[model samples]
Target: MAKPCGVCAGVRRAVETIERALVVYGPPVYARHEIIHDRHAVDELQARGAVFVDDLSAVPDGAVVVFGAHGVAEEAEHDCERRGHDVIDATCPLVLKLHKEARRLADRGYDVVVVGRAGDDEVDAIASRIPGRVHVVSHLADVERLEVADPARVAYLLQTTLGGLDTVDIVAALKHRFPRLATQDGDACSAVHDRERAALKLARRVDAVFVVGSGSAVTTRRLLEIVAASGVPTRLVENAGAIEHGNIDGLTAVGLAAGPSTPDKLVDAVVARLKMLRPVEIDVLDGVEEFVRFRLPSRLRHAGERSSPGLGGAPLAPGAALSHDR
Candidate 1:
C-alpha cells in the first residue's frame, strides 16, 4: 500500500482518539460540519453514530456537540452556552491562531481583508468581528480595487488551508498597492506549506501531478498552482472518481499528493484509478513532518470535578465544570 500524506494521517489519528472517548447518548454526538472536509472520514464517523449539522437550530437542546476542524464564531459559542449544550472544540490549532491574529489586527485599527472562498466558515468568522473594516478578496485581481477606510492601515489574514504560492502573489499585489500593509509572522499553516513544497519536488521529476481534495478546499487548489508554476500538467480532483484519464495521457511520471483535510482512503483510491490508465511507479516523496498536538479541554482532564458532563463522554471528573472555560 502507498503511504498516506502526513496531514491526512495526523487527522485520522485525532478522529480515532475522539472516537475512543465517545459515549453514546442524546442526539448521537452532533458535529457542526464535515469534521475535516473528507467525505470518507465524515461518512465513517456517521456510521459510528456521529451526527453532522451545519446550523445550531438543527442540534437539539442539551445535546453534546463537537466543533469541526473549522473553528466556529463567538456567536455560535454563545448559542451553545445559552442552550445549555456541551461543546467540544475540535478546531485545528493553526486555524485558531489565524482567528486570534485577525481579531488582534482589527482591534489595532487595521482594515482587515480576510481572503479565501466567500462561504468558508473561517472567512465568515473574521468578517463578523469587524464588519465595516473587513474586505474579502479571492484572487490577485480582487486586490486591484480594494476599498479600505485607510490604505496605510491595511492588513491581511488568510484561511489556514490556502495555497502557498497563491497567497504570495496576492501579498505581492497588495504590497504594490499599499506599501505599508502588515501580516502575521506565519500566514499559512506549516502542514499546507510543507505539502505544497513536497508536491513541487515531485512535479519537477514528472510531467504531471495529481492533487486529491474537495473542489472547495483551498490547499488542494494551491498544490495545483504550485505544480503548474513549473509548467507541468496538473489536475485537482476531490477523489479518484473525478480524475479524467485523458488528462494524464502519455505522461511518463506523475506526482501524487492530497490536502491537509483529505483522507488516506481517497489517496489510495486515486492511486488505484491511476493504475488502470498505466503501470505507474509510485514514489513516496519526502517532506516535513508535523508533530503538533493540542491539549484536551481542562475540564476533560479533571472530569470528576465538573458539576456537569462535557463533550464526548461525561466530564473527566465530577464537579469539574470550571475547567471547561478553557
Candidate 2:
C-alpha cells in the first residue's frame, strides 16, 4: 500500500460538511455541485437526502446548499445569496487560494493566464472571476499560440487539482514567453508533491500498480498518468471490484493507491476484496501523514456521527444553515 493514500485533507473536510449538514438540517440538504467529484461519495450522500444541483436556482429558496470541494466561480457564490439559499461553501482551501491569486492579479491590471485543462471545473472557476483576458494553456505547444494583449504585464495561475501538480516546467515556459510574467511560483502544497512522489516510487518496486479512485476525479486521473508513465503496468479502478481488470493474477508484487477524493471506506473495501483473491500481507510505505484541514461554514456544528442509512454508511450528523450575508 502506498503512503498518503485515501482522501486528502481538503476533500475530507468537504465530505464531512455535507454529511454534517444533512444531519443538522434533515432531508434534502442541497449541494451546488458533486462534492469531491466521486460518484460513490455523491450517491451515498444523495441517498441520505443530499440533493445536488449544478445551478443554485434549482434549489428551493432559503434551502441549505453546499459547494463542492473543487470550489465554484465567484458569480455562483453571489447567486446563492441572490436566491436566498442557506449556502455552505465546502470548497477546498487550496482551490480557494488559487482563486485569491486570480483576483489579485486581475486587480493589478495584468492579463491572468492559467495553465490547465481548458474545460476543467477548477479552471473555469478561476477564469470566471477574472474580468480581463484569461488564457488556458496546457502543453508547451499552447504557449506559442497565446495572443495576450500585454505579454509584459501577464500573470499566470495554476489549476489547484492534478492539472497543477508538478507543472513547474509549464510555468517556466510561460515565464520565458512572457518576460514579465508574475507568479507565486511552485505554490502547490507539499502534500500534493509528496503523494505523487510516493505513487511513482511504489510503481518502480511493484510489477503492477492499481489506483483506486473515481474515474472522474482529477487526482485519480493524474495518479494514473504518473504511474503509467513510469513504465510500469498501471490501471485505475473505482474500487476493489474493478481490480480484476488489471490482470494481476501472476504479478509478484502490487502497489495500491487511493486518490485524494476517494473515501477510506472504498479503499478498505478494495483491500478486503484484494485479500480475498489471494493470500497477501499488507505494507505501507514511509511518508508524511497529512493533517491539514480547512474551516467549515459556521453553521456546521459537529454534533456527533451516526449511520445515515446510505449504502455502506458513513459518519453523518446534523447542523445549522448559513446565509452569505451572515
Candidate 3:
C-alpha cells in the first residue's frame, strides 16, 4: 500500500462543486474542460449532467460554465464573460496561487520562467497570462536556450504537479546559469511532496509498485517516475482491470499509489484485485496528512442551498451529493 495517495483535496473540491451544480441546476451544466484529469471522474459527472467541452463556444449561450481544476487561459474566462454565460470557478486554489505569482513576477519587471510541459492546460494558462514575459521550460536544456530580456531579473514558477527532484534539478540549472533567478520557496504542493516521500520509502522495500491514475494525470506520472528512479520496477494502471496477473506473479510485496484525481473506490478495487490474484501483505506506508478544504464558489453554495431539500433534506455539504458507488 502507498501512503498519501488518493484523491486530493483540490480534485475533491472541483468534483463536488460540479456535482452540486448538477443537483441544483439540473442537466446540461457546461464544463470548460475535464473537471479533473481522471476519465472515470469525468464520466461519472457526465452521467450526472455535466457536459465537458474543450472550448467555451461549445456551450450554449446563457448556460453556466465551469473552469476546470487545472485552471483556464485568461482569454477563456474573458470569452465566457463576453458571452454572458454564468461562470463557476473550480480552479484549485494552489493553481490560482501560481497564477497570481506569475502575474506579480511579470508586473514587477521580471522575466518569468514556468517549469512544466509545454502543452499542459495549466502550463498554457500560466504562460498565456503574461505572454511576452513568460517562457515555459520542461528541461534544463530549454532553460539553457532561453533568451530573456535580463537573466539577473528572472523568476521561476513550477507546475504544481511536477516531481520534487525534477523541479529541483531544473531550478538548479536555471540558478546556475542566471545566478540571480528567483524561485518559489518550495517544490510542488504539500500533497505532492508527501506522496513522493512515501513512494521513495515504499520503493525501497517493495518488489514492485503500481500507480493507479489516468494517463494524463501529471502527479500520478510524477509519482511513478519518483518510484522508478529508486531502482524498483513500477507500472501505471488506470484501474483494477488494467493490472495483469503476469506482472506480479512472484512478487510478495507490492506498493500502490494513486493520483489526486484517482477515486478512492478505484484504489480499493485495485487492492481487492491484487489480493484475489495471490496471497500478499498490504501495508500502507506512513506519509504527510492533509487537512485542507476549499470553499465552494458563491453561486454553487447558493445553488446548493436552493436544492438541498431534494438531496436528503439538509444543506448539501460539499461532496455529499456524489454517489461513491458510481
Best candidate according to TM-score:
3
Q: Runs in model 1 with CA error above 4 Å?
A: 1-27, 130-132, 207-210, 213-218, 221-254, 265-282, 296-326
For residues 150-196, what per-residue lDDT tens digits would candidate 2 score against the true structure?
77899887766643355878888888888788974445645556678
Candidate 3 lDDT over 102-163, as tens digits, reads 88888888999999888888898888887458889998789789989987899989887776
* Cα lDDT over the full model 3: 0.77
Candidate whose lDDT is highest: 3
Tens digits of per-residue lDDT, candidate 1, 1-326, equal 11235244224433643454364343378877666666666676777778878798899998888776666777898999999888777666666677778878888899988877777777776676664488888888899878888889999887766666657888788989989988876646656667777777777777777777776655666666677887877777776877777878787777787767676567777888888877877778666644443444443444222211111112223342221122
Q: Which candidate, 2 or 3, would have the higher TM-score against the true structure?
A: 3
Give Cα-based local distance difference scores for all models.
0.67, 0.75, 0.77
Give the Å error, residue 303, model 1: 11
Q: Of the candidates numbered 1 and 3, which has the greater TM-score value?
A: 3
Residue pairs whose backbone atoms clash in candidate 3: none
RMSD of each candidate relative to the true structure:
7.2, 4.8, 5.3
